[model samples]
Target chain A: MEEIIKRAYLESLDGRRFGDKKEEVEKIREKILSAKKIVVATNNQKKFNIIKDIISKICNATITMIDIDTRFADLTRVPALNKGLMALDTETADLVIARGRLGVPGSGSMLVILDGKGRILTASLSPSSIVHRENIEDRIKKEIIEALSRIGINLEKY
Target chain B: MEEIIKRAYLESLDGRRFGDKKEEVEKIREKILSAKKIVVATNNQKKFNIIKDIISKICNATITMIDIDTRFADLTRVPALNKGLMALDTETADLVIARGRLGVPGSGSMLVILDGKGRILTASLSPSSIVHRENIEDRIKKEIIEALSRIGINLEKY
Candidate 1:
């Protein structure tokens, strides 16, 4: 699966070059395959579509894609209580649980989803940035449930 | 911007319900807005296309979308020296620098790209999970440059 995607990335790069085209593609491939979880940071719908669609047609590991960046960055969100948010998104920790620490100073916890491998994924600091602990957990849970349902993953339905 | 995207997620819901549609949409919206950084976790290319294309037409905050999930989870990657990768991706830190601390335990430093508020974006561990420091940064840089080039941002050309 990783290999196929690497090829897709390599394929996406034309002969066009500023430095060394081959070197560039190889470099990109290295980065692409590194993620424990896949969280794409893209803003262009057309381009994203083209790359995924083209690469997907070939055989590879198939997964889900969602639009988290409706207004802000709905790419893939990695929520944390506070500190672990980074640890989680970066593939350092399988899970991260932080509390009372962030821009809001005293925020809550957060989480994101992943299927396999290191769980390359997304991250975000809940709007509850200012919200205290205890209360934030329920909020994050509700939000995750909500996100899952949007994409047809209704646990209740199941 | 958060409001706009919340609506987009809500609008995408279409009142379809196995449970409470309104509640479901609202929950989804809350989750969507929480991310400190925007890393969308999605797999369906077509659905992603429609959401972004339609929503983009409306406009709140425009972003760059790429094929991070080309193979595995190319959605986006958060590279770290050792730790703090999550900190970077989840908007905790504008930057994180780690060394010989990831799955590769002895792996080197890592970094991701971000702009504005928090870096709502993507993340992944390096394939060099076993590789040491010094070597990984150059490799990561090359890969990033390759990625940037693919999107038509050729620094060398510039």
Candidate 2:
């Protein structure tokens, strides 16, 4: 898992410069394949449910949703608790996936995956045009699969 | 401004335990007052506009909206670029205010203000109920003033 995450980080760095969504997704998919336990961190239950549902359908990994504020209520007062530190403190998960408000109305969201050490493995801003489509669930699912395929994860087998 | 940010950071550590909205706002208000130049960082243009509008109404500080991806397109490929490092690299601003997707369907937003050093001075998860009100613009304006007042800022003068 660590090796996969390191490779993902390296690939993500290369992909981000060119804004290559395919490469970014491919790297993340590789990390996801090696991850046995994952935590989806967010304050909104709705977003959590959607993400949890989607991940479950594609992988056999153990998934959990953590309410950011609830889990870090104590740290909220800690002045040094930046996003990375907050994420790093989640010791239970090999991978931490966090969702935040994109400030855009109707679709489009930022998906960031962090390793146990709080290193950002991959981040992507989902295009609103596609996210705002009628079948958002299906679209998201398809995107996830396509991205994962680059890393050799066949959703059909899962 | 450094002193104000320090004081706000200290106060934030105290108020986070109880989730005190007023205290959180007050600390941010102080931070804002001391900030000469501020950068509002986010990928979504709509979110940037709203935040820019709100901050402009309350203070005379120089504000700029930075599209996170545009500025860090090259760094995005860098594996070491965590959220803190990303905010820190914006050398133009004494302070960087960032907005993330809250995963909520509408209204509610998470606001985080980080000092030049990337220390989160203050953070707030605005309540959705208040955010989703009919007159959102007016409500946001009012809320900004009210929160600032806790820190002794008379928005009426600004």
Candidate 3:
């Protein structure tokens, strides 16, 4: 059975841009592989659909998405609460996908993976925010692919 | 100019049921009349759209709905952050309408009004809950009508 990895990411206002891209996804992918349970702290279907597609390719994990009012409910907003909520609900914690702010142009993402108990596991940054003309979706795809490749996560089929 | 009155309500997870029939809607309507801005926290388009119809009869102020994360961003888990995010964003802050949590068999609702700067002008509790067996649409309309009647807001055409 694919392990569950609960994590959260900040979706850009335009529905694009994630975070500091330096080796982030790769590190998160590694954690996702080893985790037994995964939950995402977001209710946005659009965000979930996007994350679901990206994670499935990198690691085979049973992921559940829960929508929390990240915008105004938590201290660091909804994204930060993702880890804490998962730690409380799941049998055991695995990894948390943490992304930095996604407001800069062509800015890569910072993906941090935390343990099931909300401890930092490993981190990888995928730097891909150089191109200005590229669309946000394309940029995100490029960065995710790079991160996965760097961490030896196979996403060729995806 | 039609003063746009944003009606806020809480939807119980169970369904719609309320103990007092007319009194509930009446209360919510009063809140609407005294309000200058409204905020609905849920990202459900259906709910927001339904609200859009109800408020139209009350007043003609500008109505803006707050966006919530669908699958990954659940408001229940992070109510504070969700509220905060709405407050931080300039657009969301303009008109804040938040739903309250009233647990029962029927859906629950509350109405909140904010000023131009997102200040809390007034707040009102909705009448129906998850325990109410009446049709939600009818309940909503009836509640609005009752509320308006109390505040001396007449909507004969609606």
Candidate 4:
């Protein structure tokens, strides 16, 4: 069977297999795990602050915000905007996280993970809508952890 | 006290009062009450279809879609975009509805209501995240009614 799109995206972010170049493989993973600067770009100042808190809850890093787009216009494109910025030599950070309305029929937001070099590394298309029995933040936290794990950046190791 | 922002926006859309030109005022209200065309604009093909269903569930009107813009980028801005189109003489419909991530610290989407001329009318912030014992669709239906009622469009009159 073929690997899912999320795995493929993560692999593209950091293409290193278990059997190849033990030292270099560990080096890339170590840099990602120990990344200290996180960049968040969105026009929603309130969400930018909330996302900053969400990131702090999982890892120790400073979040740099870029609020350069029109409100409501930039809801879902923050990830791609940062990706473009990174490629354009503007946003050079350890990691970038963007969240907005998922396209599918649901009542939840979609979170996208991008590496320092502006490569997307996750498959979070349809995170379940907030269920009554659980905290949505917790569910999203787990989703983030799982996404990072797939891309060779395990949060538990820290 | 002065009207809140939502009411004010709606007022700007249709500025007619009970004291002047009673027949003309009633004529416009009747037009709105009997609106047959609903326009929904969003880049999400899946959501475009889902919104079509939602509109059908509310009223006996057909939906026209305008899907232009990058994905994830136009989530919240759909309302304003349609408003712009209306101003630019592009979209000339009876009603416009857009839903996306609310710009606040919550796990819910924001639904904005606009008239044929792209005038907004409604104050629907803080719709509770889906609850355990309640069906969210029913709740939102009620909310939609309340919003319409505030702008003097009684859904129950149908």
What lDDT tens digits, residue by residue, belong to model 3 across residues B1-158? 11232212232323454443454445445555555555655566766677677776665556656554423323344332335335435353335554444322133554444444544434444555545667766655554455345444567855
Residue B115 lDDT (model 1): 24
TM-score, cand. 4: 0.35
Model 4's interface RMSD: 8.5
After superposition, candidate 1 runs with Cα above 4 Å error: A1-4, A11-109, A121-125, A129-134, B1-158
- Model 1, residue A81: distance off in Å is 10
Error of 1 at A128 (Å): 2.1
List TM-score (chain A only) for every prediction: 0.32, 0.53, 0.50, 0.51
TM-score versus the correct structure, for each prediction: 0.26, 0.40, 0.35, 0.35
Residue A17 lDDT, candidate 4, scale 0-100: 35
Instruction: Return whichever of 1 and 2 wins on lDDT.
Output: 2
User: lDDT by residue for model 4 over A83-130, one digit each (tens)?
Assistant: 334322345687777655553224455566666765554535434465
Interface Cα RMSD for all candidates?
15.3, 15.0, 5.4, 8.5
| Pairs that collide, model 4 | A72-B77, A76-B72, A77-B72, A77-B73
**Best-matching candidate per TM-score:** 2
> What tens-digit string does per-residue lDDT give for candidate 4 at B50-141?
55655565567877766555233323323334333332234567777655545422445555666666555453543436533456555455
Best by lDDT: 4
Native contacts recovered by model 3? 0.20
True contacts kept of 1: 0.02
Give the lDDT of residue B61 in candidate 4. Answer: 80
Q: Of the pair 3 and 4, which is ahead by lDDT?
A: 4
